[model samples]
Target: MKYLIVHDAAPGQFIHIYKHLRSEGHEVVVASRRGTTHRLPVKQLVYELPEELKGSRSGYTAKVIGLGLSLYEELKPLAFDGWAPDVILSHASRGASYFLRDLFPRARIVSLFEWYYGAPNPDTGMDEGAFRQQAANAAATNMPISRDFDCMDAGYTPTLFQRDAFPKSWHRNLEVIHDGIDTDFYTPANKRAIEVNGKRFRKGDEIVTYAARGMEHTRGFVEFMAAISEVQKRRPDLQVLIAAADRLCYDPGEKGKGLKSFVDETIDYDRERTHFLGLVPEAKFVSVLQVSSLHVYLTKPFVLSWSLLNAMSVGIPVLGSASAPVQEVISNGDNGLLVSMDDGQALADAMDHLLADQVEAGRLGRAGRETVIERYGLAQCLQRQLDLMRG
Candidate 1:
């Protein structure tokens, strides 16, 4: 089968899916707004749009209007290129869906439901009033796309969650497939342990952790920092490494700036204990996970990040918040630990327990890796996508 996979950018998860489809002997083409310069295995088709539509904008209204027109203009020529698609899989909702449908009407349209408007906690990068209005508009845009599509697919979220967020009637078509991990790529390696500054870590050095970008209040960065501080009070040996690409947001000097409101000022973080190594390469990132004893993944009631899954794949036992997708994946005291989203004390306690119990932590990490291999491996996900297309 020939598949056209569309996403805003080449999300690592979607790229894995694209590769999976290709390995199964299916012709896959990936469409993105940004030009493809990276060495991804699949065929890439870049959708060029106007300069105004590309930059960081204030409201969703302008973006929606710009996206709709830009997509129409960009995809108009694909209809006559003799590049007929058997299925059109997309994320970011209607823009890609509508464009692909116009190009190939008979193709099965399977959209990955990463989010819906009324979900418990959404990542709206704006004020409350503005966010609500934008969310309503986005919901309005998505409704028609869902109605028109033949199938809707979700990676981690359950059917009930999707139904609750969207119109209840559309639940019948929703497919809940576990987004798989490449066990081989993420497996534990025997590389020399390195510290945050690339120095060799000593045999018994303590390394507490957090990994994510845009350290906003909603993303649980502040809470994680507080938790680390609390944990460090009792276990003074522990050092926290906050690994991410954008370090400017977390800097105290950049407060009150645009999007910097997400940063919290109350927490008095220790500079020496808290090391922010702004975005290392992928190989080094994975190495950090392998070397670290405990990994803390915190989020509000939002979508599960691919990073958490990758952590699991790499055999790092995670202490995550009991939110929607985290709760869905992690069973407390089983594969990994789950703590309350808001309670810094609880998070700190969980961290302390995991750090103290080396045997238990190792067991959890091994079990977590096994779970990924058995249930959420890349092969299983690929077969599921094939089944959806065949159906």
Candidate 2:
């Protein structure tokens, strides 16, 4: 089958599937804006957007709606180039193929959606920003994506939490499939020592791991820091290994300040014991997890992080936020432990308990690894995605 991917410059959501498709003799073409399209193994048709279409007072969804039209315009010649695609896959948040329905009328278009958000964000389900007062803005914010979705042949969400976030009317139309974890690559390994920024952590080190977690409110970074610091007070030998960009991706902060500095100013943690590896490579990250006594993941009611699954795949005990999304993956005291997103004391207690009780931690770690292998295996995810593309 011929496949065409519409995406932004960053590595796409279906990268592995596309590479596998190419390996299996399927022709794939990616029409993307200029960032990281070079990573794809398939042919690519890159386009540049006009300056004005690049950004606006509106959010990324709005910006992409404008950019999608430009992409459609750029690909107009493909209608006569004899490079017709059997299916089109795109990230709904990114600029996708819009206004090309007439050109590729026979092509099946599928949009991959993550979680949905509105004025009164689910994280702060407070009295402020009532849906009624913000209804118009919210609808307009969602209008472009909704309109594009209406024209799709199928909609896909990686989790049931995400699918259910869509209107109840669209639930039946969307299917849940995980992006999957490479168990073979992420599995536990025995190591004598791992080094990061000149600090070497050995097998006996009581390392607490956090990964790909920006210092933001949504990820509950503040809570994690506080909880871990409390644990540190009790366990003086405990060391923290964090791998993430110091920037805030989901929350607005003061200009010229990374959340690391903000977090330092607000939260009191042992700086000497904490090693900020600021987004380490995959090898280093896995090594960190392999030596970890416990891994901590905290998030609001938002899209779940792949790092959480990666840590689990490494057979490490995970203490995650008890939000709906995290709860879906972690069964407290079974596969993994969880506490309320904002309950700093609860998070600290869980961390301390898991770190102290190695036997119980090992059991949870093994169960967590079993869960990932059974449910989110890489082979199974690829097969399901291949089926989606075929349809």
Candidate 3:
């Protein structure tokens, strides 16, 4: 089968699935905007918008209209070059290809749906003020996207939580298949000592870890820091390691300061005990999890983070926010523990419990890895995706 994947950026977890398709002798081509397209093991076509469509209110509006046209225009040359695709897959947010159905009338077009926001959302369900108003306004931005989706052949989402976020009408075409984790690579290892800043941490050291793409309120950075201070009051021997960019991604306003600023304002914990590894390499991250006594992950009612699954795959006990998305993966007292995102005291208590009970922690950690191996294995996810694409 010939495949044409349309994305705003490079293939992320789809890289593994792409390789598998190529290995099976299927031809694949990627039409991307900002990725190392030449470096990927596939034919590539590039599309880009003018530089003016960047970083302003008017620019954002121009980008939305211009990007769709640019993507469609770039692919016209490919069609002229005699490269016909059997299927077209694209991110739902990139509504460009929704207009190109006439060009590939025979090909099935699948939208890789992620989030669909509207009023009364889970993210603002507990809100009492401006958050609710902001979320409702944000949902209006999806009007054009919802109209474009009407022309899609099918839709696929990584989770039921995300799938349900869309209108109930589209649920029939939307299927849930997570971007799986590589269990073999993420499995527990007895790395006897992990060195950080010239200090070696042996097996028995009490280490606590919090990792994310960014230190944002959506990930509960403030709550995590407050809990850390409370936890330190009880166990000053605990060593903390935070791995994330120091800025916000979802909400980038001045009020959305980094974790350090939050810590500086609210907490008085010993700075010497905490280490901010500010987005380290994969090897270093895995080493941190391997040596960790407990791994804490907090998030609003948004998409589940892959870091949570990665930590679980490494066989470490995770204490995650008791939100819908996180709750879907973690079963309390089974694979991992869940703490109320609104309760700082409960967060500290859960962390202390998991860190103190080594026997129970080990049991939960093993179960967590088993969950990943059984349900979210990479090979299984790839096959499931292929099946959806074939349909």
**Which pairs of residues collide in candidate 3?**
none
Q: What is the TM-score of each candidate against the true structure?
A: 0.81, 0.91, 0.89
Clashing pairs in 1: none
- lDDT, residue 275, candidate 3: 83
- Candidate 1 structure quality by residue, lDDT tens digits, 1-391: 8887776675444766676666678887776766533556767666544567555463444555556556556556666776677777777454544445555677776667655655224564566876676557656656535534544443223224443465565556666775667788888754547756655653246776677766665467777877787788888778777676543333223343323234345665666677777666778777777777788888776555667877888887789888876777788888999988799889888999999998998898888888788877888876786677567
Error of 2 at 236 (Å): 1.5
Q: Which structure among the candidates has the greatest TM-score?
A: 2
Against the true structure, candidate 1 reaches a TM-score of 0.81
RMSD of each: 4.7, 2.8, 3.1
Candidate 2 segments whose C-alpha is farther than 4 A from its true place: 36-38, 55-62, 121-137, 252-257
